[model samples]
Target: MTTIKQDTDIPRTLQGLDDDRSSVRLRAALAAGTTPDARFVDKLIERSAIEPEFFVRDMLTWALTRHPVSLTLPALLRELRSQGAQARSQALHTLSKIGDRQAWPSITRALLSDGDDDVARSAWRAAVILVPEGEEAGLAAVLATQLGRGERETQLSLSRALVELGDAVMPALRAASTASDRRVRAHALATERLLHDPDAGFEFAIEEAKRVVALGGSGQEG
Candidate 1:
């Protein structure tokens, strides 16, 4: 049985990257993507665009998945704005894993429907997680736009994120209940109502308490 080598071998193991064996080079590139070492990251970014084979490029993108969120997210965001489909898709996939506010500009900008369904879907999913925890206007805008496009997954994911953000999203959540899309409206309402039911979701309950305190807790007195 052939054992998979550890990432310790990493970039060095893929010595065949420029060799005749495509699989060898590709696997090596993917392995190199794991290290948080600064120099290795630069090498991955360099290879992301120039790698000859499509699958090798995919492996290089996969490497970015394990990179530090702070380092990898910024690089991936930059990649998202590029015109190449592979560059955008791979970067989107990695950012979805890290999901931070720093990801907002790129992911939110690409949230609209234009060309690819999967890429659009991935963008919405990442946006739902990465947007600021309390940016109601921004959250509503992204959700409303995607909801208008009739993507139920987008609506559901956004509603779930709003729920995760606590009652700060209540105003927007309430507004979303009136969305033009019935599915969006229903999902938003369900999320809003969950606040009153502790058993509905533990995370929602914790977030609700945090939101209440953040709002000065005056309402809970009544």
Candidate 2:
């Protein structure tokens, strides 16, 4: 918990990030963010890619956001191409927190539909936050392709992302509500329900959708 002030403290702070104990790493990440030094940016990003502890990785992301976007953007964008899943997921998460539209181009289709659930969830979050105006529909269409993917948590992430697009996602949701895959139809219906009524919980909406789909309905009122 030492305070970071002098230039000499930089190297120690950098080393603390890689310390064996998670507490040391946590304090190091906190110090990096507190000081907001450009020198700490790269190291913070690198640690974010592999940090095992969720809290520490979150702190690492906070530290990255503390730096100039110009310094952090390129490095984070490079992380998207990393072979590591955590690397990609953490970078996307940081980008979403940064909320800079300039990072939108990096939210590629591949990332949106990434094979890894965590990576794809992160990408969905980043995409919704960074998607530019006049492109929500296209983004929603692409997001629709992911309906019925993964378990409940993953499905909820996709639903939330689609719901965030507002009315622009309606067409895609409607189309998916009739997909040959019942899971896709159920997910789409659940998402559409969430879109119209935000208070409807995902569990409730999805269970209702499943019933409707089972009865050969699309949850679309004719």
Each prediction's TM-score versus the true structure: 0.54, 0.97
Runs of candidate 2 with Cα error greater than 4 angstroms are 1-5
- Provide the lDDT at 198 for model 1: 32
How accurate locally, in lDDT, is each candidate?
0.58, 0.95
User: Could you tell me which residue pairs clash in candidate 1?
Assistant: none
List residue ranges in candidate 1 displaced over 4 A. 1-30, 33-62, 65-74, 84-86, 99-101, 110-115, 148-155, 180-184, 190-222
Using TM-score as the measure, the top candidate is 2
lDDT of 2: 0.95
List, residue by residue over 132-216, the lDDT tens digit for candidate 1.
6556556655554443333545444544554555556666656655555554455555556564553576345334533543554
Which lDDT tens digits does candidate 2 get at residues 99-156? Answer: 9999999899999999999999999999999999999999999999999999999999
Kindly report which residue pairs in candidate 2 clash with one another. none
Assess candidate 2 and give its TM-score to the true structure.
Answer: 0.97
lDDT against true structure, model 1: 0.58
